[model samples]
Target: MTINIIDHFNEYFEMVPAISDELKLEVYKLRYQVYCIENLFLNPGHYPDNLEVDDFDPQSVHYLIRHRKSGEYAATTRLILPGTDNPEKLFPLELYCEIDNSGVMQPINREHLGEVSRFCVSKEFKKRKNETHTLAAIGPDQQDYFTSDERRAFPLISLALIACVIKVSHENDIRYLYATMERSLLQFLSALGINFIKIGPQGDYHGPRWPTVIKITDLLDCVAEKKPNIWNFLTNEGSFGQTRPIEKPSKAVRSNSWVGT
Candidate 1:
């Protein structure tokens, strides 16, 4: 029998909003494992409580993907909403990279913008052969915890995180998402029809990353057209429909040349 990717993924994993302090701690602890322990991307000594958090956490809404069978958090991501009182407050991308204000971003309303940040998959859930260096310690006894079909759907975790972002963005009336993404991640997302426009030169934050932006409407339309099943999964069977009318970026706005140091 052929497996429906959406059903297979839903069977083994669930997406949860980290609204309560307890659930939020789960998100933070998972981040600590990925960013501090596994990747060494952040200083473990700084987070004495063993929860990876920053000033942005207070302004962000977090989400987690949990392995239903294991009851363990598999991944976590956060959408940093625009400041309610101060809409002009710069996002992490604005502060760290030079955004080209003359083109596509010039007319954007900051109040309708949010940044996708702190996207990380837990080391325990990194099951792909190419991801061996992720350092997910699987015990001998737990080797068979995931069936072959379930393991095949593991890549859906990232898409589920994006779905979380979309869900929250819709609730908050956000129209554009800003992100500083690794090139590999950009390519992967592009291949899935979730394209982001590079708005700034590559920077060396968390290893080389490009400052990128995507309209929520455009993201949904592309996914819905190119991959209907994945779109159905992301939108929860059309429950999270587009909040705003589709608007295409003008041809006059062009991506900045990908300059790397």
Candidate 2:
């Protein structure tokens, strides 16, 4: 049976905005598991509470992909928006890697820029033998949740995270996104028409990572042309086709704005 990727994804997983403190903690804990314990890309000692967090988190919007059946958060990602108080503040990529100013990076608007950071999937969700050591490989135990055909759609988790990034960025009026990504991940995304331009040479950060950038409009256009299904999934049926600026909320209102499932 040919699976409808979007329907299959929605049936088994949920894209939740980590808007509340409790949900944000869930995002941090998942990051701690992936970054600190599993990958050792970060030192567990640095996060005594076992929650992986950083300075940019204060200016970021977090999202989690939850496995509906198990009620476990299978993956998490964050979009680090520009600082409200200091729009000129440097992103992590700026501090860690040298960006190429000669080409596509020259016209970036700082006020509308955001970075995709700490994107990871829990080990339990990674399903292939070769992917065991990577950030998103699934375990044998998770196999019971799906039939063989359904299992083929497992890679949607990564796409779902990208969808989250697109949604949040649109809501916040963010146009450009920066990320330091592994080559394999970049290739995977590129194949799906989600191209991110390499703006700098590879740098050693947790591992060899290439600094990249993508304009949200350009990405959407590419995906829509080459892979309409994926574009539909990412844009939620064209809802994010236009920028919809979300009003600034008071601290209290923001805290109560969303509840993750």
Candidate 3:
């Protein structure tokens, strides 16, 4: 039987145009679930209650999915515009990243560039893989967990977000795309056909680290082959984004935010 990927995906709302209180609480809850419950990042606070949310929250565009039946925030993510307001253009390293801001070369051209960060799934959606380790599939409900289906979904969402980010950049009259990331995720992105330039390293454990200069047009070109499947959400159980347990998460740096479903 054919599967409709988006069908399992809950209702999503962009946290831009306006900020609803319900939206705010949902996003914070997702943050608490992932950052606090899943990956305790030492800096504990009641802010997100489950995950982490810093000053960046105010400056970024938020995205969320909710249960149509319950209207609960299921999954959440935020995008940081390269320049304008967002420090990513200037520092690339996210909130936790620290550098001599005066000495660092800030990002340029607010138009085409943006950083994707703080992605999280609500804890209610997260599920544990088998003891041996494997991926999870989209079940009846929820959004925050890194199930096997999401592993497949992340790249697709990243690609779509990249496209949207660029499209928005064009509308905003900006050019050039840039974001700092890890060597491993960059490798995975490269396998999916994204070509990026290294911008050298920057930041603390909670900040942006080994950075890569991602050329958006070039990335689109490499991934163009799977455009239809990706754009159409042709994702399935055996997709490239299969979810797996983080046996040694510290070994490989993950840029996407967390949400345990």
Best by TM-score: 2
Indicate the residue-level lDDT of 106 in model 1: 81
Tens digit per residue, CA lDDT, model 2, 91-121 = 9999998777548877988999999999889
Point out the higher-scoring one by lDDT: 1 or 2: 2
Per-residue lDDT of 230 in model 2: 75
Which has the higher lDDT value, candidate number 1 or candidate number 3?
1
Can you write out model 3's per-residue Cα lDDT over 159-218, one digit (the tens) per residue?
A: 333433443443444345546554444655566666666555554443334544554445
**TM-score leaderboard ranking:** 2, 1, 3
How close to the true structure is residue 19 of candidate 3, measured as C-alpha lDDT? 51
Q: What is the lDDT for 132 in model 1?
A: 35
The local distance difference test score of model 2 is: 0.79
The predicted structure with the larger lDDT, 2 or 3, is 2
Model 3 vs. true fold: TM: 0.56
Is candidate 1 or 2 superior in TM-score? 2
TM-score each candidate: 0.86, 0.87, 0.56
